[model samples]
Target: MEYLPLFIDLKNRPVLVVGGGIVAARKIKILQRVGAMITIIAPTLCTELKKVLFKQNISWIEKKFQPIMLDKVILVIVTTNNAKLNALIYQNAEKRHILINTVDDKNKCSCIFPAIIDRDPILIGISSCGTAPILVRILREKFESLLPKSLGFLSKLAGIWRSRVRQHIVDVVLRRRFWEKIFYNGHIATLIEQGRPEEANKVFKYTLNNDVGNNNKKGNVTLVGAGPGDIGLLTIRGLQVMQQADVILYDYLVNSEILDLARKDANKICVGKRVGDHSMSQKELNQFIVRLAQKGNKVVRLKGGDSFVFGRGGEELEIISKAGISFQVVPGITAGIGVTAYAGIPLTHRKYAHSVVFMTGHNANGDNQVNWAALSDYQRTLIIYMGKINALNIRNNLIIHGRSINTPVAVISRGTYQNQKILIGTLIDLEKLTRIADYPSLLVIGDVVSLHSQMHWFGQKALNYCPTYLIAHSM
Candidate 1:
């Protein structure tokens, strides 16, 4: 610990700044936000500083620095270009016992500006002891993405309830436990973020009576969709539940990168199921989740894409409900919609196909349950999920049932991911197009596939895909 980290309240306090350039203006802005009464002593003020002169807390003097200006000043900031002058001011402030900060000079700084994430009433400060400023900046960027923007609002709401909570609970240990329970309940945060303050107040009041220091410990479960291999696409509500979860059960397709965002102490269990690989039966997994929740653990069943879309989420919900467990679902962007957008293939186009159908090609009985005749219409787009192994059957059925052999087709594997691959061909070449691609591929049939070349936008090599009939379409 090279420097002791402390957050001092500077509201309505006198502070002096010894320069008026852009850097100095930045320092002034931070001070202003903290309600500091600031005076800048310099020959001229920068354009930014000039714009804020009318502010009640800011004052400027168009004069050079002098020792007498340190009188009654609680702190001083030196941002001048001249090293000698900045050092002179630091020495003068030091002799008078006034704390000083010199911009870009760690030795002269009695205080250094830390990287701040201001969720007002809740501020997170990060510092590298002024040794690794860039590293600290990178850390700030990472946190900026992980933290919800509604955090400040949540903090403000908590502050509003503090007095009431303290009055009702009375005991210090009980009050602390009560607040911890509130933080663990994702529903309360969801209500506050959704602009439902009245509903949120009701929940808070309910928790105060039923949950505060109560021995009746019954935890809940949340079904969260991880989306299509993109951590940025995870919902705010999903992130909140993940952070609060004591145990997380994830699938094979759920992005590992997204799981890294969860609490470090969380227990992660791999209940992933593939086509022929069964980690655990669906019934067994459901019982496991219920058992964990019954023991008062916050359990999150994290799946890939929309859990309702062939993710067997409905089945799990049924099982959990039968077990008398509380559960909620946080929907995610399903592959039928998300992957098509990334591959630049619209599921429905007015000039091409108006109606879009999403169907599963991998039926458990290995039978063609979908109506090939109805889907053969040229006016509709067909999006088949997990259709790679059954590509030959799908092609034969579509062509045998009035579809054109020359109809455009596309197979997108690992859509919206860094290693995603797209293959283009006609219906006659459907099997060939899917042969070289990876599993979890999406099969798109109809004239909409022609738009892939025109709308290709997701990855760097999107336009560089191998195609059997590139000459039939315009690139």
Candidate 2:
């Protein structure tokens, strides 16, 4: 952090600017946005500065830079072209321990103005610690592209909820978690991203319900799909369930982006099951879910991809059923299909595959099982979930069992997210492709994989690719 970023409420606050040139004009424009009472001291002003002075009711000193001009100022800016004058302003302000910026001269200034991205209450101040102004501008531009225009409305929504959260959630730890979950969870972020202020406000109010845990109501459980790895891929219902959850039991493959949606007040207990490590045993997890629900708290079983697919949702559902807890299932974009589609490979095509078969790579029964010979003979697209670790074995098994070695294969890592990677190969080279790709990936096998060369269009912007009609006609 080059400069400590702080938001000073300048409503009726006094601020001083030492020049009336373009630099001073720029600073004044920003201060005006925050409703600051601005005083600019200079003999003359640029047309832009004069226009702002007339429009904003800013006082003009119409004189040289004097040390006495710093009196009663809460913040100061020295934007004159003269280096000596800037240094003098910096020195004088330092004596009074006042915060001041000296235009582009970082050495002379007590503070440096950051390349600011403002959605009013949702202000993002970016600085390269004063090393690179151009870099900071570039970063600001990138953020501008990613963040939506309705962020200002979302910030206002947060401002309205802040007092309610503080009044209700007394525990500091729980409160912090609640705010973290709001930002990390996709619901609020997605609302802002899509510019839906009204819906966002509704979500905000729902999460901070005043009568949240008053009665011993039979808690409801929502089996939510966290959606591949992308937070944005989570559906509106999935985000809502996360926001109202009292406890979130999430798996290892669930992306951090999806976890960010839960209420900051919610308890997040990771039950992510790895190859050899289990955070919580199935029985303990079952008991924990029942106990939390009995306490009248909404519980969310957040799983990566579609909870019903290979996510062991049936086991959790059975436990909930026996416990007589109310539960609902929210489907997610399954990674095997989602990754392949976003990578531009359709699982089923009339020209190639007529059907798509989704299967798990690991057998929970702990046996060398799957009937490979039968699967190999099936005339359909095969999508293997949790199979990155055994890609080579799966490929060889299918080949030895009668599947063609020339069958196209695509390994997708971190599917549907910004950092997603895709590797296209053949069943014969699936092992080599696995070596180059990371885990939490999917394997797509069949003729559909050949479409990726033409269809790979997930992260690319519309302008980067030819129109779909044009591409199809060209093909």
What are the TM-scores, per candidate, against the unseen true structure?
A: 0.77, 0.52
lDDT of 1: 0.84
lDDT by residue (tens digit), candidate 2, 1-475: 4467776788788889888888788888888887899898998999898777776649998888888888788789888888878788888999988888877777877777778888776788888867888988889976775555666776676677888889878988777766655533435555554456677667666766743433334466779998788777887777766876789999988988678767898999899888789988888988888888777667899999888888888998899889877677879988876777778989888888888888987751224578776668536788888786777678778888888877777777877877777876667777777777777778888887777767767874212122332333345
Candidate 1: segments with Cα more than 4 A from true spot = 42-47, 145-175, 182-197, 210-213, 230-240, 264-295, 308-383, 389-408, 416-421, 445-467, 470-475
**After superposition, candidate 2 runs with Cα above 4 Å error:** 1-215, 364-368, 460-475
lDDT of 2 at 175: 72
Residue-wise C-alpha lDDT for candidate 1, range 1-475, written one tens digit per residue: 7778888889999999999999999999899999999999988888999999889899999988889999999999999989999989999999999989998999998888899988787788999988999999999977776676677877888888888898889999887766666543545765665567787788788878777777545667889998977777888778877987889999999999989989999999999988789899987998899999888777899999988998999999998898877677889988888888888998888899989988887851235577778989988999888888788888988888899887888888898997788887888888888888787788899898888777988884443344556655645
Q: State the local distance difference test value for candidate 2.
A: 0.76
**Per-candidate local distance difference test:** 0.84, 0.76
Best by TM-score: 1
In model 1, state the lDDT of residue 213: 73
